[model samples]
Each structure stands twice: as structure tokens, then as C-alpha cells.
Target chain A: QKEVEQDPGPLSVPEGAIVSLNCTYSNSAFQYFMWYRQYSRKGPELLMYTYSSGNKEDGRFTAQVDKSSKYISLFIRDSQPSDSATYLCAIGGTYKYIFGTGTRLKVLA
Target chain B: EAGVTQFPSHSVIEKGQTVTLRCDPISGHDNLYWYRRVMGKEIKFLLHFVKESKQDESGMPNNRFLAERTGGTYSTLKVQPAELEDSGVYFCASSQAPGSEETQYFGPGTRLLVL
Candidate 1:
């Protein structure tokens, strides 16, 4: 099984809508969870990260991790056109870190 | 203090040719990583370097790929006889230390196209 699985969504939403992106992992050893945003022609930028099962809020972005279920999510509240980009979920195992197929989001103005 | 930076923002080369991509990590960072994203695929890890030493390189696709970090400074990735499947965006990242919780900062990435 792939270490991390994420829906490659070209999801479109109106501005000010709340967006939820998620990923699942089969590995139970993953302790670090992160959300990264990537713009066209640019590398992934760290959005928010959580160490364990819980929700972390940073401005309009919220990252939640459920280690028990091996699930993680990134919630964007009041999303704007500037939030239009690819969102990637990453998890770190003991030996290495793995990334998911990013979800492309377009917040239409 | 600059974030990670990569050179040759875009490169288009014919197959079987050689290409070298460079990366300058954040100053004072001890941990550097190389990643690649093929067309329509997720970004994948290539290797990890600790200072001038290679900490882990199991993600390298094959023997045609080589990476180096000299003097614990900048790093380079060289692909000899590049293939069509090798076309992808190459990303370089770095962190202060492997143990630290600080997130890895990424470069703008080098977009490589092999024809």
C-alpha cells in the first residue's frame, strides 16, 4: 500500500467558502503531519504542521491530525482567490517523510 | 537570510543528455533534501544530506542520478543520460537540523523537460 494517499482534486469553490483537504496513511509510525501550499512554478511552502493528534490553528488555516485513524486534514476558512494552489499533505515516519498527491484548489473570485 | 534557492529555473534538453541542477540551502542549515515531481504525480523524496555526508539516498531512482554536497555548503544533482521519464520539477529543501521541529524551507524548484 502507498504510505500516503490523497485525492488529486481539482476542486473549485467560491470565494469565502471553507475548504477541507484530507489524506490517509497506512503507517502507524508517522508522528509528524504537515500541510504545504505550492504555487505554479514554485516549490511547496509550509502552511501548518501538527506533531500529533489534535488541531492547530494559524490564521485562517487549521491542520488536524488523527493518529488513531491514521488520517489528517487541512481546513481553510474564509478562503480567498489567493488560496488557489495545490495543497499537499506530508507525513514523517521514523526513517523518512512521504508526500501525497496534492489537491489543486481554485477559489473563484 | 534567504530561503532555499535553486538555479536554472527551467531547462529543456534532449534525452540522453546530461543535466546538472544546483541548490543553495538556507545559511547554517545542516540538513538538505532533494525531491522531484513527475507530471501528474506527487512529489517524491530523492535523498537527504547531513552537512557534507549523505544521510539517506534510498529514494534515488537509479544509478544515472548523482547528488553531492561539498564542504557542507550548497548541493548539486546531476543526471547523466537523462531520460524522458526524468522530466520533472526538482525541489531542494533544508532545515536547521534533522531533530528540530522546524519545517523545511523549499526553493522555487527547477523545471526540467527531457525530450
Candidate 2:
């Protein structure tokens, strides 16, 4: 199994909607979970990250991790067109990071 | 301060040709990483460098790919006799420390196309 898995979603939502992106992992050793935003032709930018289980919020973005289930999620509230981009979930190990196939999000105006 | 920067934002080369990509990390960051993302695949780790030393290179696909960090500064990855499968976006990231909790800042990435 792959270390990390995420839906390659071109999930579209209207403005002011709530958006949720999720990823699952096979490695129980992963403790650092991160969410990154990538626009077309640009590199992945770190959005929010959480260590172990529980949620970490920054402004309109929230990241949640469940170690038992080996699942992680990012929630974006009040979505805007500016939020339209690809969301990637990364699991950090001792020396390297395993990234998931990013989900593409498009918020309509 | 400036973010991570990569040179030759885009490159297209023949399958058997050689290409070298460069990465300049944020100043003073001890940890540098190389990652690649094929057309439809997830970004995969290539290697990690702590200063001029390679900390881990388990993810390197083959011997044809080589990476180096000199003087604990900018790094470079060279692909000799590049294969068609080597086409991908190469990303470089740097962090202040080696731990998992440290945030990694990334470069704009170099998009490579091997024809």
C-alpha cells in the first residue's frame, strides 16, 4: 500500500461554502501532518500543520489528524475563489515527507 | 527574507540528454530536501541533505540521478541520460532543523519535460 492516499478531487463549491479535504495513510509511525496549497505552475506552500492527533486552526483553515485511524483532514471555511487550488496532505517521517495526490478545489464566485 | 528559489523554472530536453537543476535554500537552513512529482503522481521525496552531507537518500530512483550540496549552501541535482520517465516537477525544500515538527519552505519548482 502507498504510504499516503488522497482523493484527486476537482471538487467545486460555491463561495462562502465549507470545504473539506482528506487523506489516509498506511503508516502508523507518521505523526506530523501538514496541508499545503499549490496553485498552477507554483510549488506547494505550507498552509497548516498538526502534530499527533487533534485539530489546529489558523484563520479560515483547520487541520485535523486522527492517529488511530491514520487519517488527516483540512477544513476551509468561507471558501473563496482565491482558495481555488490543489490541496496536498503530507506525512512527515524522520527524514523525508510522503505526500498524497493533491485534491483540486475550485470555489466559484 | 527571500523564500527558496529554483533556477531554470522550466526545461525541455531530449530523452537521452543531460540536465541539471539547481536549488538555493533559505539562508541558514540546515536541512535541504529534493522531491519530484510525475505528471499524475504525488510528489515523492528524492533525498535530504543536512549541510554538505546527505542525511538520507532512500527515495532516489536510480544511480543515474545525482544530487549534491556544496559548502552547505545551494544544491544541485543532475540527471545523466535522462529517461522519458524522468519528466516531472522537481521541488526543493528547506527547514531550519531535522525534526518532523519544523516547517519546510519550498521553492517554485523546476518543471522538466523529457521528450
Candidate 3:
């Protein structure tokens, strides 16, 4: 089984909608949960990072980690057209990083 | 204050040909990593380096791939006699701190196509 799993979504949402992205993992040792945003033809950039199983709010974005369920999520409030990008969840470790198949999001104007 | 930078933003080579990709990590970053993502696949780790030394390379697929980080400043990944399966986007990342929680900054990957 893969260590990290995420839906490969081409999820579309209207402008001003709320967008939710999520991932599930099997490793209990994972301590850091991170979300990265990747635009077409560009590298992924860190958007949200959490070290605990709680919610972290940053502007219009919120990252939640549920260690007991081994699940994590990123929520975008009032999504905009400029928010179109691929959201990737990464599990960080000392030796390697396991990345989820990103969910491609498009916010229509 | 530059983020990681990768050379040859894109590459196309005939099967069995050799290709070399380069990465310049963020200055003073002691940890460097290499990853690849094939078409429709998630990005996968290739190797990790710490100050000119390879800390872990278990992700490297086979003998045709080689990576080197000289002086722990810049690194290079060379694929000799590359195969069709070697086509992918090669990404390099660096973290200033070696801790597991340190955020890693990634470079725009080198998209490789082996025909």
C-alpha cells in the first residue's frame, strides 16, 4: 500500500465557493503534515504546514491534521479564479518525503 | 535569497542517450534532495544529500542513474543510456535546517522526455 493517498481531482468550483482538499496516509510515525500549491508548469510551493493534529489558519486558507485518523485537509475560503492550482499533500520525514497525487482545482469566474 | 534553481527547464533525448540535470540549492542549505514525477504519477524521492555526502539514496531506481553534490553547494543528476521509463520531471529541493520539520523549498523541475 502507498504511504500517502489523495484523490486526483479536477475539482471545479465557482468563484467565492469554499474548496476542500484532503489526503489520507497509513504511516503513524508521520509528524508533519504540509500542503503545497503548484501552478501549471511550475514547481510546488509550500502553502500550509502543521506539526500537530489541529487546525492552522492562514488568511483564507486553513490546514487541519487528524493524527488519530491519519487524515489531513486544506480548506480555501472564498476561493477565487487566481486560486486555480494543484494542491499536493506531503508527508515529511528525516530520510524522504512522500507526496500525494495532487488535486487539480479550477475556480471559475 | 534565491530559491532552488534547476537548469535545462526541459529536455528531450532519444532513448539510450545520456542527459545531465543540474540544481543549485538555496545558499547555506545543508540538506538537498532529488525527486522525480513521471506522467500521471506522484512525485517520488530519488536521493538525499548532506554537505557533499549522500545520506540516503535508496530511492534511486537502477545503475544508470547517478547524483553528486560537490562541496554541498550544487548538485547534478546524470542518467546514462536513459530508457523510456526515465521520462519524468526531475525536481530538486533544499532545506536550510536538517530537522524533519524544516520546510523544503523546491525548484521548478526539469521536464525530461526520452523518446
Candidate 4:
């Protein structure tokens, strides 16, 4: 089985809608959970990072980690068209990183 | 300060050809990394460099691929006699602190197409 699994989504949402993206992993040793945003032809940018199972809030984005189920999520409040991008979930050790297939998001005005 | 930058934003070569991709990490950053992603696949770690030394290179796929970070400033990944399966985007990233690496800044990867 793959270590990390995420649904490849072309999820579409209306402007100002709440968007929820998620990923599940089977690796119990993973300590770092991160979310990244990527635009076309650009590198992925770190959006949310968590050290363990818990919740973190940053501006309009919220990240939640549930280590028990090995599930993590990123919630975008009042999503805008400008917020449209590919969302990637990544877990890593001190020296290496593993990524999940990203979910493509589009917010229409 | 500018983020990491990669050269030859895109490359197209035939199978069995040699291709070299370059990465210019952020200045003063001691940690450099290489990664790749094929079409519809996730970005993957290929190797990590600490200045002029390779701290971790376990992710490299095969002997046909070679990576070097000389002088601890810029790095290069060369694929000799590239295979059809080698067609993918190669990325380079760097971190600010040498210890407990965090928030790796990535370059606009070099998209490679092997025909």
C-alpha cells in the first residue's frame, strides 16, 4: 500500500464558499503534517504546517490533524477565485519528504 | 531576497540523450534538496545536500542519475541516457536554517519530456 493517500480532486466551489480538503496516511511514524498550494508552472508553497495531532489556524485557512485515524485536513473559509490552486499534503522526516497526489481546486466567482 | 530558481524551465530530449538540470538555491542557505514528479504523480524526494556534502541521497532512483552540489551554492542533476520513464519535472528546494529543516522554499521545477 502507498504510505500516503489523497483523492485527486478537481473540486469546484463557488466564491465565498467553504472548502475542505483532506488526506489520509498509513505511516504512524510521521510527525510532521503540512499542506502546500501550487499554481500552474509554479512550485508548491507551504501553507499550513503542524508538528502533531491538533489544530492550527492561519488567517482564512485552518489545518486539523488527527493522528489516531491518520487523517489530516485543510479548511478554507470564504474561498475566493484567487484561492484556486492545487492542494498537496506532505509528511516528512528530518531529511526527506513524501507527498500525496494533489487535489486541484477551482473557485468560481 | 529571491526564492530558489532553476534553469531551462523546460526541456525536451530524446531517449538515450544526456540532460542536465540546474538549480540555484537561496543564498546563505546551507541545505539543498532535489525532487521530481512525473505526470499525474506526486512530487518526490530524490536527495538532500548539506553545503558541499550530500547528507542524504537515498531517494535517488538509479545509477543513471547523478547529482552534485559544488561550492555549496548551486547544484546540478544530470540524467545520462535518459529513459522514457525519466520524463518528469525535477525540482530543487532550499532551507534557511541548517538544523531542523523547515519551510523549504522550492524552485520553479524544470519540466522534462523524453521522447
Per-residue lDDT over B31-80 for candidate 1, one digit per residue giving the tens place of the 0 to 100 score? 99999999988889899999999999999999999999999999999999
What are the RMSDs of all candidates, in order?
Answer: 1.1, 0.8, 0.7, 1.2
Q: Per-candidate DockQ versus the true complex?
A: 0.61, 0.85, 0.79, 0.65
How many pairs collide in each candidate, listed in order? 0, 0, 0, 0
lDDT of 2 at A99: 95
Q: What is the lDDT of residue B87 in candidate 4?
A: 96
Worst 10 residues of 1 chain B by lDDT: B97-106
Model 1 TM-score, 2 decimals: 0.97
Candidate maximizing DockQ: 2
Q: What CA RMSD would candidate 1 show? A: 1.1
The CAPRI quality class of candidate 1 comes to medium
Off-target runs (Cα >4 Å) in candidate 2 are none
Q: Tell me the interface RMSD of model 2, in angstroms.
A: 0.9
Q: Looking at model 2, give its docking quality level.
A: high
lDDT of 4 by residue, B42-95 (tens): 999999999999988899999999999889899999999899999999999998
lDDT of 2 by residue, A1-109 (tens): 7889999988999999999999999988877889999999999999997786988999999998999999899999999999999999999878688999999999999
Error of 3 at A83 (Å): 0.8
Q: Candidate 2's error at A87, in angstroms?
A: 0.1
lDDT of 1 by residue, A60-103 (tens): 99999988999999999999999999999998764356899999
